[model samples]
Target chain A: MTHATLALLTLAACAPAERGRTLVIAAYTTPREVLSEQLLPAFREDWRRRHGEEVRFETSYQGSGSQSRAVAAGLEADVVWLSLEPDVERLVGAGLVTGDWRGTPTGGLASSSVAVIGVREGNPLQLHSWADLEREGVEVLTPNVRTSGGAMWGVMAIAGAADRRGADPLRALGATLARVRVMDKGARESMLSFEKGVGDAIITYENEVVVARRAGVPLDYAVPAQTIRIENPAAVVDAYADRHGTRDLAEALVAFLGEAPQQEVMGRYGLRPVREGVDCPDLPALSEVFTVRDLGGWEAVQGRIFADGALYDQALSLSRGQR
Target chain B: MSVRWGLAGWAITAGVALWVGALVALPLAAVGAEALHRGPGPALAAVLHPDALRALALSASLATWVAAVNTVGGLAVAWALVRWDFPGRRLLAAAVDLPFAVPTLVVGVLFVALLGPNTTLGRALEAAGLRVVYAWPGMAVALCFVTLPFVVRAVEPVLAELDPAEQEAARTLGATRWQVWSRVVIPPLIPPLVAGGGQSLARALGEFGAMAVVSGNVPRETLVASVYVLGEVEAGQVGDAAAVSLVLLALAAAAQLAGRRAGRWLGAA
Candidate 1:
């Protein structure tokens, strides 16, 4: 027999007889990694308390929107704790999630604010506001909105600048965008690119910059005058759990987000509490500090301002000309 | 008893076939059906969007350049390692596999360290009026780094197996060194080169880790197709992403087929 046949048989035979378990997770950045790492032990402990069985989590964490798309395409994720509301709204539109997915918890995961441009120590160029991005010789590095969920938030911050600038921040923004040296597909790369000196500044999620600083990357964040509030939502994958006979465990896992876990785990990840009375770091609040709303959503925004090819072409032309 | 065993064998085969049909092939079949049936409404809209097209073009162009350059580089390296026994020759021979052993992501980070703006080399390049860390040149460099192994490995064995008598005969016929290499040494290398070039092209086309780290996935600039597909996938646009992926797969497959055909032609020649 061929190697393919033997491998198939081996995989099939290796299946556990008692019951199998898997958690379909959709999260972004290192916090997602932390969840898969530090919190799994605790979550499984909670699972065994209610279900009397061992469990496993099959997680996919990248940008929030990507995770939402996976679920829409029949990935059958049990919990989708993604970075933004629109991602959950995607599931809502597809009928996989309820419109009230946000209503599940007041400030559970959706309570995090959008990121600001973080620069290396000493504030080189004295970057004070979003307007600084327009300055010549100022290199801005942000994640590609096409691949990064937080990148949409970054676009919203810039579009807000356009609105604040009153007619044609695109020109100003375009000039500033010309300075963008790197456009990573993910938030972490955006940070790493900046730290690696690919750019003078980067616009990313606040949690991401914080995580970078925590990881000893030597960076500081600058909140723009305007920014978007990033809401992350969670849900259970019904089909996969039922198939794996881990329904009791799945239900317990989702239901466990009631309050204590929010203050304990999600809060530490820089996500504000959905419900009141949950303690966290004394960071600026998304509500009090920023004029927040979706940056015209994906359907509205993609073709107009942030279409992938158009942006790249313009950037490419600019870079080539300079070279 | 033989008939019974045959029936059981057929049953097992059918079972495994059905399982594969349900899981892997079924989803792909769905994508194929969707791609073929779905109009330019979403997919075409995405493709026509300058960013998607640019990514496609950039990825294609990079793959092409990588294949061409690596063909010459691979043959030279392989010929030297196999034909010549210079000092530290064994070390150099093993070094060809270094690209293979290093993760693409790590290679990207390495390049970022070596050529990023912060680095002395990168700073010097920038001062000299060039940007290599986050531009198309950056993408090309990263792709070349990842795809170096394909041509070298492919040609190495072929060169090793080559009969020395043929080259001696060519030299004996009063052919000069360059002429003997051109007429005798290169002919047999063509088939393997074509085969290796095809492999390199396929890899360079799909390569994500290195390109993602370096190119910054700038639309129309550095956004390669794989990165674009990833962007689509991330944005919860599976149909659109799948559509992009289908196009990419078709292109890669076509390139592979072209490579094989070229190999056959070279072999015949």
Candidate 2:
């Protein structure tokens, strides 16, 4: 029995390499379900037809910030599809990604969305714009900016809306944050809290709301007139790809994500297509949209707002006293 | 012994040493080395940072409350299970260990489902001006659930093994039930209770998954040391995370040592 067990273990270990190549994609948790269910099957079929062999995938999904750090700490991911640019930049800082990845195929953007208010069905609170979040007794749910890349974008979107309205951005953000009932560790968890009736509304990615709606969750989300456009970047981790001799496969997968067919699948999964002509009807139209660059890019935004003891910390301290 | 026997003995010793070194010593050494990578001053500064200090205080206070409650509650449970013969007694004893079988994250989810803002009980509690979820009390509740098995399991066997004749003798000597319990029964239970309380406290101090889901991770409010370490790591501050982790490890070590020493001293007395 022992000898037979040893033989089986050795065979199982050696089976994968003998079958075909394996690609490891580490992604943030929000897009994982759609990727596994919709995107990966299509990618696998196309890759097999092109290469005349089967290609298996190993996927790791985590909060965007944590996932980025895991890859940076040698998670051996061939491709990283994360929610924000800074997360990808961490790979650059770790020497895992070479060259200017943001200027790669399709400008390194795989999909796009915007921050929106996810409210209860029928919109009982009458929450329409960012200003409605600051009204008295209207509790909000958002993830912690320190742990969730999406939360940082939500804060930036709120600050941008405040700026567009000629309001004091710090005061506006402070008031809204004051009304936050709970800050979950990630965007998905915050949405779960909202679904559990923990808050009146949630500030989350537009795709999150769309995906929930498609899943038949009783949720109604409103796209504010002024909001921050959320762009999710995809890149091949050059160090891991070269080490595993899967560079061509990794690059092909990322490029395939930008292709029209895959873009349409992404749109169907509630992500806005990077290509202009493809439209997802579930996505609400936006009147005014701002990118990270409008707030002087991620570097400036992180420094001014989300950094330790910066605006976010100060605002939280001030609001803690009020509560 | 022959050379072959000596070689086998040496091989066995080497295996044991390797197991201990890899599983226990290596991880502790790695954390200490990384924490002190930037020198002791910076590591100490990171640990002593205001938010970290607050988190430490909150974790310690919550763990203390959890330990206190578990000590009293676990004793009552063990006493009833051992000293009584009632309907569902076996089932009640088995239910005490439910927290051990359930995953900590699932426990957090269950707490949310039961007491979240949307539930009927939750709404009633909120109307009564008491919030459970997303507050410090929610974290304490999660910790209590995860650490419930520690004290009960520790004391149950000792209680079972305790002689009923000692109590009967005290009662025959004209002692009341309260006096018999306080004089004869309580003294012998102290050592195990203290040890169990220490283990429960340690578990609570290091708890992350359940508390992470329930505590809201608010800075200087609901955030605990473990979650704070995670937030630091997420922010790409590995050095800070390592330093804070070492602080928690040190605290757990100190607490366990103090608890064991106190238990031994009390037992001797």
Largest lDDT belongs to which candidate? 2
Per-candidate interface C-alpha RMSD? 2.9, 1.6
- For model 2, the stretches where C-alpha displacement exceeds 4 angstroms are A1-20, A48-53, B1-22, B117-120, B123-129, B157-181
lDDT of 2 by residue, A108-209 (tens): 988888999999999999998998998988888898887787788898998888988999777888788878878887888777778888888899998888
Q: Write the per-residue lDDT of candidate 1 for residues B150-198, one digit (tens) a residue.
A: 8889888888888999889988989999998888888888888888899
TM of each candidate vs. truth: 0.74, 0.88
DockQ, all candidates in order: 0.46, 0.60
**How far is B60's C-alpha from truth in model 1 (Å)?**
1.9
Measured with C-alpha atoms, the lDDT of residue B28 in candidate 1 is 78
Segments of candidate 1 deviating more than 4 angstroms: A1-26, A30-60, A73-79, A102-110, A195-197, A231-281, A284-323, B1-34, B39-46, B97-130, B153-178, B242-269
DockQ of 1: 0.46
